[model samples]
Target: MHGLVLAALAVLVSLTAAASLNAATIGKANSTNCVMLIGGEIVQGDFEKFVTIGKLLLPGDDGESTRRNTVCLASSGGSLSEGVKFAKYFYDNGIGTVIDDGQECYSACAIMFMMGTATGAEVSFANRKLHVGGKLGFHRPYLRISPGESIDSSAMQIAYDAAFSSALDLIAVANSKSPWSSQPMMKSDLVQRMLQHVGNDMFMIDTVDKVGRWDIEVFGSSEPSLLSEEQAFYACENSLQWQNGLTKGDITYSNVSDGPNGKRRSQSLSKETRQAVYQVEGLASGYAMESCVISRKKGTIFGCGIDEYSDARLGQGDCDHSNFADRSSSLKAISVFNPATKLEDLRTGQAVVAVQSGAARCFVIKGSQITDNEPCLVIHVGDAKVRGRASTITHFVWPSGSKTVLVQSGTSFEINGVSTGKRTVAERGDCYLNSATLNDFCVLTSPN
Candidate 1:
């Protein structure tokens, strides 16, 4: 980060007496780092200037090890096409981005800032002599709906298509970058939600707390990485805020016991409403955990839901055991199952047999990408490939011919399923099982 700050100062020292470039500016202050300044509204030609300048100032194409690049952007935002181009430049160049004090990085500017992480670039804020308080914002892509005019089906279809295309571009940029270096900038669902969260078309990610929520590695020079493996597991577990209609008191607390070799205690909060929240703390297992919500009234469920399935945080130990979709694979299969009804809704009393999918003998999916495909479930039970989805998997027969059934138990353990007095089914007892999705279930005959 010091190198980044110094690079910024170098840019300030080299700028002309005008004090403002009002356009994308680039210059080389030293042998190791190039400083780029993007100001005003970003539009066409900025990306070309950035690339051409990088090639001119940075010198070698393989300066990845020797040369460091810092980019400072102050803009309101403009043309999504140009924003995409700008992001592509940053992703390709792996240039760091910064927003010093008094600088405004709103809308597309914020999007570009997030894109910086895709390339494993350091992004920060400076508030020293020439800098002001920094601001990073997000909003839905600019919509072209005419004022006071209703959109016809065809026009609405076109808008939806454009928005969908933008989402795909964002996902591609995120997936192209490795999670170890880049970290999760944001989840696909968050992108979709933030794009529609506000009517004014802006969602400012100004506070450190808000920025901490996203899959980001760097926020400011003073701030540390927010999406560490432990932090991500923490985020997955307690990330949900009690919303309207949900009372704070309705959420209860319970202590974890230290008796089990794995000393983890989970506090369950049951609501008069359909949702229930559970907080698991002090998990001893090396496996990571993610918090999930299930509807007691609904008969289906999915672990973590759309908001928690972070593609950017996938390989960062949070979901290391689960296999990922290949890079060349596109989400070609569309799932006919309505996720909410078929997944989120828990059956009246169905047993849940959650299993962790690791490199060893485990359940395999037909497709790697869960977002675009139905991923048919194939479990390796003994020497046979047993076909079953997570929800469809009901019974797990022990090696001794004893069977454990997955019954819908409000708490973690089920009493009626196995007839073993009180057998632990899922939850904190097994971290791998704790994180498994409703459709990711498998029967493990042995730990190996």
Candidate 2:
């Protein structure tokens, strides 16, 4: 059995060329000491390199008395075969993995990181700590498409699908042994999204939410970086629905209060089954509410729905809803946004002020992308302070989270009781006025 498996692994490894794999001990086990594996574009010989490095760094002769081994990785993924081989080796050695601060482990490297946990090959979570400031990205198994080669054939298509399935399975296995049930391995939807949106470009796990989904224990000083407010706002706006009879822009000053279960709490939700719903009110058209369902594994918004009516409230179906918009039922008005608009075309270094629902937000414009066919952006919300000049002003506030007011461009407002004309800011207060109101209710600030 062992020989057959080795033979199969060898055959897979032979599919690629020579690879670069480097290893060295950086510290001791009690000190969280680890063997650092640095590689570029995994290849065939890489497996052998791990074998030699494993002996030098974590010798088998050490027996049970030896300190638990930890491995740190900085790689951009190479051969899938080599990646699998190395992951199994790490598991067999009961080795832990780390993506140190300021480092990156993308593609196959991320696989190694995922597998170096209690579930894949390691015994427990005693020494494994995925520090912040490092990047871990995933995409589909990369394959070269020869020039002028058509993949239209059914046989070729089958082969391609098989390869993708195998790749996803490998990733799933890596994440299967998470220490926390709240954080499990990769999910099918997440893998599909990677294949769709990420493509050749890396889908970086930049947020704490994203990292937490993978169940990789984080150890760092930085808070989870806030993603583009524009994207969040867009999600909130498009997700709204007038369920028992509500129209868009018919009213303002809505209040979205998440229920007791919706409020942020100490207990973490299961990555697979986690959900929350907001109870909306204060609208001219009676009561309205929106619910956002997220995939904890990917830390992404999957499906969102809203109900507008005096009696609109969450049903059992709303809490455990699909990530995609529910448009099948005609009883309620629903708008589903899939593969959100790509924000790559948006110019950076600009500011955009947008209002939706009943809240206002100002974003330091960066760019956007359609993640998993969902629109996404990279932006920063401003505070009430003079920073720089103002630019674009989008009218409308989508009521979801907190309410902030944004003033029109070329408008001045007081900050700390002082008048400022050339700054853009996001003030902490609610500004409610009918559509006829073209007033500057919030101060603006610059990016300086």
Candidate 3:
């Protein structure tokens, strides 16, 4: 990003003009590009700073052509919607930006740092550690355990939220839904934009490519988006950790929270333990996972004494424990069915030697962002909506680390950009999104 230096203390010096006074000016040396030295933990407030500084340098679409803006991210991530607003500014202005890896662009920073892509920029990294994981970051969509029976009057604040949320929303929402944006966002689209959303208003969420399918959404690694049966089963069945192993298919469910209740629950609902239950008996979970649904009233079947149903039975609420009840009803359980049994039990952040039993699976929670150097299969329960560097998705699809199933139907070919087995009921081949081999390429599958 240019070896030139621009200290905040420096910008506080050079940008002494009148019109730029109200603006949070950044420093630009010989590079002509603006450099913002981001420090301290990331906050939604910093995003406004990004916008103000960017506007100061590049002006707006209404003004002369916007100059490019580059951010030197060296802090932890904060706020999802805020980051998006900041990034949206760069994106709309056709500005390019970069994130030096040595400077930590932990959470929302990494996503917004991509604003450079608005002008065909790159999500460049410096030469340091890049921690990528989970989207329920410190910014946007704030939450707090309401005081006893006080869910409505819970002590919450939308302090660091940004003002550009409205304008950003109009553009992002349309772009997300636009067909020319390339891939249409399915209702099941797996785009995690909390980093790009606005307001700490969690309920005000956005959905792109609503034409396709989606399986689930997670607030983070440990919770579902809400308590609807749809939300419950969002990604339940897609959680497969192994091709074969003792724990591979040993499905377990626990602590199912009964709707807006939060009195305190300590139990889960799932099927009995069997040798083949969670195994790759025939290289399939046998059949592709249908949008299964479970229920205390409908789906509870007696198998090995415990009741269980297909992965579609995601939101089958059974836990009636008083502890799970809500007072003001604002603090409610988001998941009626938890797809994870022992996902938290695995040692993931460890540096260990490799083995190929494939028993452990990445924590399967929707909307929970995942970034890695190795391969991973991001299974969207219904219709899978995916994006990012192919490595982020391709590796997560099939075991080969090369094969991925994008938007599989019960049978038959879906559309262009997608290729199926030419059968009515066979699994899809590979689906690619602008697949360009060496660095880019995706195996695409969609409905025709």
Candidate 1 — worst ten consecutive residues by lDDT sum?
327-336
The 10-residue segment of model 2 with minimum total lDDT is 330-339
> What residue runs in model 3 are displaced by over 4 Å at the alpha carbon?
1-34, 42-48, 55-68, 120-141, 144-180, 184-448
Residue 91 accuracy (lDDT) in model 3: 53
Name the lDDT value of residue 377 in candidate 3: 39
**Model 2: per-residue Cα lDDT over 306-347, one tens digit each:** 444333432322443332345212111112111121112111
Q: What is the TM-score of each candidate against the true structure?
A: 0.39, 0.43, 0.27
Residue 115, candidate 1: C-alpha displacement in angstroms? 1.7
* Model 1 regions lying over 4 Å from their true place: 1-34, 59-67, 117-132, 144-167, 179-185, 198-201, 207-209, 217-448
By lDDT, rank the candidates, best first.
Answer: 2, 1, 3
How do the residues 230-282 of candidate 3 rate in per-residue lDDT, one tens digit apiece?
22232222322110111234233222223465211222233432110111111
Clashes of 3: 70
Evaluate residue 171 in candidate 2 and report its C-alpha lDDT on the 0 to 100 scale: 64
The weakest ten consecutive residues by lDDT in model 3 span 12-21
